[model samples]
Target: MMRRLLVVACVLLPLPAFAHAILTSSKPAAGGSIAAGHQTLDFQYNSKIDHRRSRLTLTGPEGAPVVLTILPSSATNALDAEADLKPGAYTLRWQALALDGHITRGDVPFTVTAP
Candidate 1:
């Protein structure tokens, strides 16, 4: 009975990385440079966000986080963040709960230079 219970626990353990709203990819590929200052940052997720409270941050080269909250009335599949970027590498950090109730968070790096 102990052996069977142990197996069940192992199988049922939450795989947050799999279920959470993982940032599968982003428009400005990680560590890639955007010649034109990114007027917008787009994050593509493995799942839909909670929409009500999803948040995005653009971390400047100096490491200050700039908040880019969604517009609430936007589409469901995509999460958009609008920012006026300067010439520097920026890190994108995001968090959201999926429509399925899984909490997700992660970061992607990008660069912006003079046009």
Candidate 2:
């Protein structure tokens, strides 16, 4: 009876929930530089994400933030986009929604150098 009660208690207890969607890697890496012109913007997370609901915002040296259209991805944990850029400082802001319903946001600051 005691063993059965202990098992029941364990089952009733709430399990600890793990947080989701940490940014693991990015193209034009943070504080890094990339060649100017057409480029691929990629951001990878630690877990699967909902690309449909995610956002990618890019702010250029012109001091304007433009919402970049995210492209369809074969990768479940990465967000991909494309842009035509000039040699300047830029910030890629990302908001990702994980499959588990968690949202994570961050920015990648990088420079675009003359090709």
Name the top lDDT candidate: 2
Model 1 CA RMSD to the hidden true structure, in angstroms: 5.6
For each candidate, what is the lDDT?
0.72, 0.84
Residue by residue across 1-115, what tens digits does model 1's lDDT show?
8757644554587454335577777777787877655476777777667777788878887787888877655466568867777888788888887765556788888878888
Which pairs of residues have clashing backbones in candidate 2? none
Model 2 TM-score, all chains together: 0.82
Evaluate residue 81 in candidate 1 and report its C-alpha lDDT on the 0 to 100 scale: 69
lDDT of 2 by residue, 1-115 (tens): 8757644554575332323678988997999999999999889888888888999999999998999888885388899999999999999999998755657899999999998
Worst window of 10 by summed lDDT in candidate 2: 10-19
Candidate 1 matches the true fold with a TM-score of 0.74
- TM per prediction: 0.74, 0.82
For all predictions, the C-alpha RMSD in Å is 5.6, 7.8
Weakest lDDT window of 10 consecutive positions for candidate 1: 10-19
